[model samples]
Target: MSRTLINRLSHARRPLLALAIVAAALGTAHAGYNVWTGEYTFTKDELQSAVDKRFPATLRYGELVSVRLSNPRLVLDEAGNRITTRVDAALSNTVIPSPPVNGSLALNSGVRYDATRRAVLLDNPTVQDVEVQGMSQYREQLNAIGAVVAQQLLKDYPLYTFKPEELRFNGKDVEPGAITVAPDGIRVQVNLR
Candidate 1:
């Protein structure tokens, strides 16, 4: 549910890489059959751009407290096979004349491929922590509200999508099959449809 980052990635990431080009016969070694497998790697910068579009969001709680979240910084967790995001937050409770509370939030999310959309999206995302500067008293409430808002804003958020040309190569219709979260980037293997 964010702006398309594939246009840029389509130019940088290679798809449908021929992994095994074994020759059928010794004489035809140079003309090996084409293996239509694809690998899509998403850089951190590309992922960040996808996370940035859904920002500057506002959600009100209990008709008094309102939370505004923005500037989501996404960190890839190859070990956990997920992404951790930190966002700047502002909380304002109309019950008092106090200024908005400033803080940050840490959220972790797994990635999955949506065939219908032909894109990789956030899966099972959760807000792990919330830190509000000078507003420890509201941390508990803010955390609760942050999770709700994050779910609303980030649920099914698309990280990357394959372009039409990238999906089709040598007369094969390919789709995303395997998803790997790695240190360098998120890699997706395209499977023939």
Candidate 2:
């Protein structure tokens, strides 16, 4: 009886040891570790600095022209997420402020920043009308203001690029206008016009 009991105990021990080994192997397989270096660290600041340098202070705004902008829209895609933006009302401006010339200069226009894509987007922007030589030269002044802003942005962010995807003038969709600006914000209309 003693011999038989001892043999049964040894057999149980072998299976228990095998189960422990299998559990350990699975744990290691599921562990979160860098496959190559087995380490992880944050690098957001370093990446942001490099992006800022590449894009610099120029090309913040575009050339100024006496034109009306109505129903602007923007579609952004990041990491498989799509974001749609639009403005409902139209805007007119004469003296758009220059883009940030340097880090010290405050941005005259509001811009939405997408950290994932490293992109900055400007919404409906406007500048007060200015008088030149006693004439209401709103168009020329607007164009000049736009030029200044664009130049500054270009300098600051050289890598920034824009492609026109759609144009919505007075609520009608225009092809090839990528970014749209609406002061009152976008609204959904259910009824067919």
Candidate 3:
């Protein structure tokens, strides 16, 4: 009777173990579908390329001829939830046919998502500093000008725009609630709709 009972218990244990394994596998698969959060990283080179494609190579303001941007650099701060960009601007004028005024500008900006527009927007960008060659006396003017230029450039150009494909999971569209930047990368928080 003891031998018979041991055989019966071993037979039951095999099926129970199999059932537990199947349940674990199913749980893992289910977890993938419920992953509402994901991070996408962008290097400075990638962002610079995107900006180059969307941003105008040159902007004009009356006498400001061929105001060109060069050597674009991007810095992300996740802790502060801010992004800082450094760029060199070459300002030329028709009146002063000499060398262009070489200026470096640093723009610090916060991130915001526009649900209605379905795009990422830079919020309240301020000019951290502007240094123009041999123009220390006009530092304030340069800073203001740089801020205005940065705002104008960012107005229509979004850092990232969500396509129907990107914001969708299992064919359902979701919203990107927040955009945060870190030293390493940018993170988009997804909100399931």
Q: Report lDDT (Cα) of residue 159, candidate 3.
A: 72
Residue 167, candidate 3: alpha-carbon lDDT? 68
Question: What TM-score fits each model?
Answer: 0.76, 0.19, 0.72
Model 2, which residues run further than 4 Å from truth?
1-108, 119-122, 137-193
For residues 1-193, write the lDDT of model 1, one tens digit per residue: 2236766565455442222223233214312122333466677888888888888788777788888888888888888998888988888877987889788888888899998897799998788888888768867776787788768877898987666666765577877777778876787876778
Let me know the TM-score candidate 3 reaches against the reference structure.
Answer: 0.72
lDDT of 3 by residue, 1-193 (tens): 6999999999989998998887676445533222433434455565566666643357777675567777767777777888777788888886768788887778787878887778776777788888888989977767767878778765445776666666675677777766667676566777778
Off by over 4 Å in 3: 1-45, 64-66
Q: Rank the candidates by lDDT, best first.
A: 1, 3, 2
The number of residue pairs in model 1 that clash at the backbone is 1
In model 1, the Cα lDDT at residue 115 comes to 82
Model 2, CA-based lDDT: 0.33
Q: Whose TM-score is higher: candidate 1's or candidate 3's?
A: 1
Error of 1 at 130 (Å): 1.0
Model 1 worst lDDT window (10 residues): 25-34
